[model samples]
Target chain A: MSAATPPSAVGPPAPGDAGVLVIDCVLVTEILTGFVREEVGKVGFRRGVVGLSGGVDSALTLAIACRALGAENVVPIVMPYRTSSPASERDARRVAAQLGADPLVIDISAQVDAYFERLPDADRARRGNKMARERMSILYDVSSARHALVIGTSNKTELLLGYSTIHGDSAYALNPIGDLYKTQVYALAGHLGLPEEVLAKAPSADLWEGQSDEEELGFSYALVDRLLFHMVDERRGRDELLRLGFDGGFVDQVARRVRDSQFKRRPPLIAKLSQRTIDRDFRYPRDWGR
Target chain B: MLSDPDVLAELAGEARPDPVVALAQGAPRLGDVPANVDRHLELIAQAAERGADLVVFPELSLTGYFLKDLVADSAVRLEGKEISALARASRAVDCVVGCILEGDDHRLHNAAVYLSRGEVVHVHRKVYLPTYGLFDEARYLAAGDRFRAFTMPLPSARAHREWRAGILICEDLWHPTSPAVLARDGVDVVICPSASPGRGVGSGAELGTAQSYDVMTRTYAQLLTTYVVYCNRVGYEDGVGFWGGSRVVGPDGEIRGEPASREEAMPLHRLERGALRRARIANPMLRDERHDVVDAEMRRLRRRSRM
Candidate 1:
């Protein structure tokens, strides 16, 4: 009511600074399944295929795929490198058995090793990226063979940080679990009735011996999920993030990576010399055929 | 079987004691006419079987909300198959459906169709087309120029007479003019079918949309002394998610009934005409509104600007 106070001083509505979004798991499951069904159906694909990695993300993705396009319509492909843990293969089989999902196992060691023989000086990161691409190639080949759409397994945390190899684990026809953070992934995995063995284990890509994703990223998924929830979803600013007690270094690094990985999430840019460039003006939805 | 006892009090003496309006909160496929029409028919039959005399669907109920150029593809004539299907279904229960309407002059309006007993009774084209935030209604569809209440003729002998009902799309009710106009005209019920998305978490309610809408609709009901029925869509389209918390707010601004959160539901509530009468008598907001003074002031402002 004071004349000195300006009316235009008000800002936009404050973002929801609520703690980690405790999801309605049932609704989320229904939505994910519906998304899968709707997305696949729109493209006229009757079946879904996922590269099962024996991790929580792929497991959740597989469960959703089964519910969406019946168990019979989903093809779980377990493509493992020669150095992959035996427990991973066993766990994949267990999940396949649990869901009545008939899985197709392909040993990708021969194919990857044959290619790497030409380049012997490849490091851990290089080998890891190569392995990811090799697995993705096998998934695509299986998809073609079985006439199924490849379901992506990367979560929002890995996605924001560009943790996965592009056109490798990231290449897919559609994804059911990409929106979920790693912590939420664990929660949903628990809700979906995955064994404690899987949930209790340190999260890894099975890239190298004892290669945990948390170790590589240098932060626990729980902390990162919490931080990302505030910084991105809630749109809290840098000052607020630090005020909320997040480490400045981690927040800065995550912000940089999310900015850097923008290209990974979008279509490749086309030089616009014509009146109708593909992404410029002649844009159509991915499911435009429907 | 939970019901509002205040509305039940009207059973003894009021002209229409219980007006059953079904809030059909469904996430319609984007730009799919025939399929959405079929889905509407299914919901109508379900609601009618549950004894709802009226069912209101979300804005752009036949076509999803975020259509840009696809609005052209989704546009349907009032004489088309979708309307025919809706009309046939209205034989069971009155239906309010949102769609892109192609007019005689080839103009299109984002409109709400009121179907009653196998006939298209009224079409209230959206008056205010929002162009902010996630909305681009002004850019895509032609904005309609008028706002008016239609009539609802119930079957009972005493309730057979036409009841004045105003229709507003998503953003129209946000403005004061539409509701004020309808309130002055003594509209008994205001049906708002919205595709409002879920946003914010701890801004007092589950969603920022829900909190703001709750305040808006409840305040409007109190001001207008009319039954406010809000039917919102659920499910994600492209990326945006609509939170479905469809409900009926009494003229007292108290929520009578609501469906479960973020799910497909057809929530039914009985609107009490006696309660509206009492609220109107109690508040008299509409009766006290000085439209003449407002009109004179507008003219004077215009004259001053011109001079």
Candidate 2:
């Protein structure tokens, strides 16, 4: 009430919006930036490591961490396989150059081949998961050597559709763009002045040659986001979408994917017949240390 | 047709005068003893002297809202020395200002204590404490369960005119039950003492808007066909801020008086409750209740539950 008193909404970085993806990037960045500053203040950390996938999500995340933790505090890892595209390697370099950080290239083709040889006749999915975990193992070891936290790059779409390899690319100490959808990742990457090549490319895990997310997932990220907006945000039913001029088959397909992938969206479910479980069985977040 | 200057002069006399209520955005008090209350009390009385019958102050007028842990000590009981001072001060121009009421139960409550004709008529505590983001009111204050309205005898020695008034505190206005109960009791006017926080969530519900608060107040007013007076506190407290924006609406939900937010200013408005009786009589929102649709289902549920 006095002249000396300050007003609210002071120094707020960005206001939120109704579209979750548009505002989620800011929210995630704010949380991660805050986390890094607070964690760094509490203890000493040598640097931050990011798995640079030459994709918009990782590029945006890497850029954010580079800004928050400084170029010297950040180390970008580019782990390409022998079958991996040259463009992917070049895109990773472009991201590193724009981010003003050096990239550490670790070709995992020989390692992956040796891994399959040791256990022959392994399924492609199993081998892919192993590859993802192998990359995370390398990142963790390098993080320990550098005394840094592993910054994650998987965006909301990858997390939502279960497109990410568990403990592989999904493994990180903190994620700055995990809440943003894949489409929003490009938007934010543009906002942060990231390289055009990284933002415009078709997103790929690049575990093997000639693999694209659309081909594997049976739908584009744009269509997934649109269907998600209708079902999740608008809370519309399948019949309602059909009545609104949507193809019934496509609506049903997206709805099924949304329902099926919900498990990956949440923490691994634990049977809760006991007193305590891995889930929010107890009010630990609220009553912790109280 | 009554002007404010004419009303104040008549009320300024020692003898009993016509009835009036002054509404204002009582700014925040960052300390235990409110500095703003003392600073604005003189000016408020001057405004009251002009024609204000009863002065309505915002929620936590003496001490600011979001006082957090300070509510324990900052909240004074109606019988305390601080309220006694306010009661005595109300006698100067024969006007009442809102104050927090701490009861004997030892639970602090957000309340509005009214002083009229050198006496306390009624003290109404808030019935709701919004526990959503940035609000932990249930942690400090207890919710009041009673619904109350009082008749203030007029000053004229021979006149039979008496104003029946009802009171609600803060979040009480948000719920339909609070105002519905009061209006059902045939209250001439409903006075809401509120301390709404500033806009933070960026949802459809925009705080500090005339329409946002007005929708709730006027909806009840139109339903009951009674005058609604809303008084809100202004200024920042900790991280949550208050946007004053006090207003008075008629039975038809028309704005009679609108006060600016973020300032300590008084705007006196007049209402004749008798004029709304016909409006209520013609299209009664109260009388058309489908008891069979509501009560029957509730009774069925109760019988099935064996409660």
Candidate 3:
């Protein structure tokens, strides 16, 4: 399709169809790999460290980083809790092997359990949040040890819905696939020819036993990706979305999630008092000359 | 100048060869004027060695785009050493380079200067300051107020006739009036230096931004009947990638040559005056343009708007 053709003229993708979200993966791969290399190299780092969850997002990120900084320069760290799915680890290892990267496995069971033992009544959500932060801590520590920048794996679908923990899985030195949606991530993974096991598995954070992202969110990625592509990227109004045959309640819920999660997408707000406050009046790009 | 019957009669019998021009697609270091000057000098030398009569660099070739607060520190005066170096390098080959110019009134402007034979011939400040959507040029720099064309002397030994040229920095070319004014002024060529960011990655092989530019440049070349030279930058600046597919389009609206996207390159193409003459003779759009009608209508519109 030509870039000039608007989504409305082409007709919005159906609720369960994400064909419009399919991108030219070859062009996207070239752009993203160049982004990783230049952004990381400017900061004086030649290597990248990524936390692998055996999920499609992280696997694609590792593959792009390997292509950007070479396979030997990218380190895939797999951190799993005691109750985490064993198949996740196996798939992550398989992905690493296919990409010619050695996997470094670190179990967070002891540290997480020791902390939760104090609050024995804590629920699964609390434990999951702690585990995410703990994994982030280990990745940063490994980044310092190996002198590599920490690369993030959060996709646009999760980021807009605030599904991932802020400053935990969301924090990184640079992200190769942050702009891509979950559906597009799968497309790019297929283009890059990732491991078949990783591609075939169900999407999950592996935070707790029997945890599935779609099941917990009460909606499939295909449905929400189509909705967000219109509501967010195309700037469609609520009434316009309803006219296009989207569920009213589902639309409101997704809109609220995006509105409430605006804080997660930005730096901490600073009150304006001085003449030139940081990120306010005194603005500079992050890649300013050193 | 071509409108003068005496000049037209004098040029009817003389033979002039096409002038070879080079488009230098470079990635300047952010806020580093001295380093970028060195890079431009090297490219100018290379273009001269390759038998190019002129070389044009991308917008803000002396300092990278997205300067924001760095604009104050990176702004250079016309008398500064950086421009002086470029002026000296132009002695070997005429060059058009971009920089943040600090005017005598202490205001900075996004400016592109045409240098020839150790002297600055013309300085064109970008009149359109795009402030919306990923651009904040108006916040840090002052806007220019006019579009004017100047005579450009060709470096070809066989061609003694000077070509009337105009420089439109990136956003300036987007407004149709900017190029229309230059076309009315009898410009034979329009040179644009751009720092266009790649965006809208859909199902197409080319970037959406690139497609828009291709359509716009081709339309302008065909309508105005002038050679269009577009030189865009490449590489990343704060995660914004500048897609460099620099090319030269003839007066017939055909792309002569273009470089690969997202890479630094220098592609050369000769601008044939014979093609320009043939296109203008066949179309006669410029000769038949009614400027008096446009001027009267603009004044009437202004009066109505005020009322």
Candidate 4:
């Protein structure tokens, strides 16, 4: 390799240019598949239970899990709320059939509605949170019953922006695509030959009838993924972000979201009283023995 | 198996041919030293069956890389039973094994032990403890202070050639001065054992970590005019996966065999003395190295920094 001019000498890419966000799909696929296989196998589980929402993130995650732990070894569970789009369920089933893995459909409307009957005035956010947690509880229950680990499907954009419920869809035994951005998730999904409907549809939480992620966030995933890549991954500061042609308000807004949602990314903090605290100074790897 | 007496007689009789080195790229169970020792013994025996004269394992092969607080729990003293077991296994073939070494001063270190002829031939603790970005080695372990080269006996048909060998554990090779010191010490081969995690998967078939290692090892081999044997581990430890791309780079900076990635593999390659001699003769970079100038400049810079 020849010594080239430093990147600092060459200015950063203009905003909306997401060329740096593009990944080598083949190599990323190998790494994620190997990660799933080793992490799941190390914990002594031969099967994985994924909460497939028919969104690109979950669909891509399930596909990778099936590739890692064979389609026969994966149990893709689709738990749809009553307000969720019917297209989601159809797309999820299509993906499962395409991967040759039989998926179990569990309608969560009964439990969600039964609990909400007492509080008729509950808002959309409350209902969405309840539905997400309800799905999480069901997935864990099935994970126990089937003796499989629950694979997470939250993408990096959702995780960094704290766009996910804390103990809801954010919880899993292992996540293969949490580090990937939303754009990268769709890229990998395209490379894996997922259902065209799943890949082409707008991303959504589907908690209510017309819930769209981009509409709620008020910006495109393509734009934010590029902005976040420069801000977080490359460690560019506020001035440097503006120098890179990012809007001042947009950069501050995304930075604030990342900071505010930091609590959602970590475990509940424990107050220290002893000489060695659990997460402080008394740290051990999660995979200590196995 | 050859008896001790038979092996001695063979060694005394005639020099053997080129030495075959095996890279035992196996995943170690976390905090399980005894089980890892058993696995090391099995790999050693298998390499012996394949007629390998030397077998090199990845960094911390006896204990998983992300030991964290388990460093104390899995650390092995030099006179401990784990090293003794590995020493006994070395009676069959020479082996380089990595572990958490509990020093006589009670300070633990990330170390590699070279065992030969049922004895602990040399131990090189990792000099640089990388403590940033997914590495917390300095927080848990002590760093080694020096780099030294030792005699490694390789059998040749012409005569008994005592090859000078040095062991630079993982991050030590990242620093130019470490390998330069060994090159100045007249080391013929640098055995690097690594537990490198795979990252930066953008626009390449290889992980960024693997690509960086390839560049560094090949550059070191060509510049120093010495063989570079790299053995990196595979498997996951707490979600971080170590990429296994163990390889041998000749003095001419050419890769000899195919490297396995993200999986357990044992690749053995022959180290040709003729190739080493030819590269050194053609390059002659090591012959005219100005060490005195470097020493003078370093002293001057140290004084200037203090001022």
What is the per-residue lDDT of model 3 for residues B51-110, given as tens digits with 9 covering 90 to 100? 888899999999999999999999988888999999999988889999999988999999
Lowest-scoring 10 consecutive residues by lDDT in candidate 4 chain B? Answer: B153-162
**TM-score of A-chain in each prediction?**
0.92, 0.81, 0.93, 0.94
Across A1-290, the per-residue lDDT of candidate 1 in tens digits comes to: 12222212122212343446577576677667778887787677989898887888888899989988999999999988889998888888888788889999998889888988998998888998888999898888888888898999989999988888989999998777777888888888898898676777889999888788887888788777878888888788987776666667778988998999999998898888988788667744443324
Model 3: how far residue B253 lies from native, Å:
0.7
lDDT string for model 1 (B166-285, tens) is 898889988977887887777888889888876553323356677888898899888778888888898776645688888888888888855447778888887766677688789887
| Cα shift from native, residue A200, model 1 (Å) | 2.3
Q: If the candidates were sorted by their TM-score against the true structure, best first, what order would they fall in?
A: 4, 3, 1, 2
Fnat for each model? 0.00, 0.00, 0.81, 0.91
Higher-scoring candidate on lDDT, 2 or 3: 3
lDDT of 4 by residue, B88-177 (tens): 888888899999999879999999999988888999999999999888899899999999999765432122456688999999999999
TM-score of chain B of 1: 0.90
Q: What TM-score does chain B of candidate 4 reach? A: 0.93
lDDT of 2 at B107: 84
lDDT (C-alpha) at residue A251 in model 3: 88
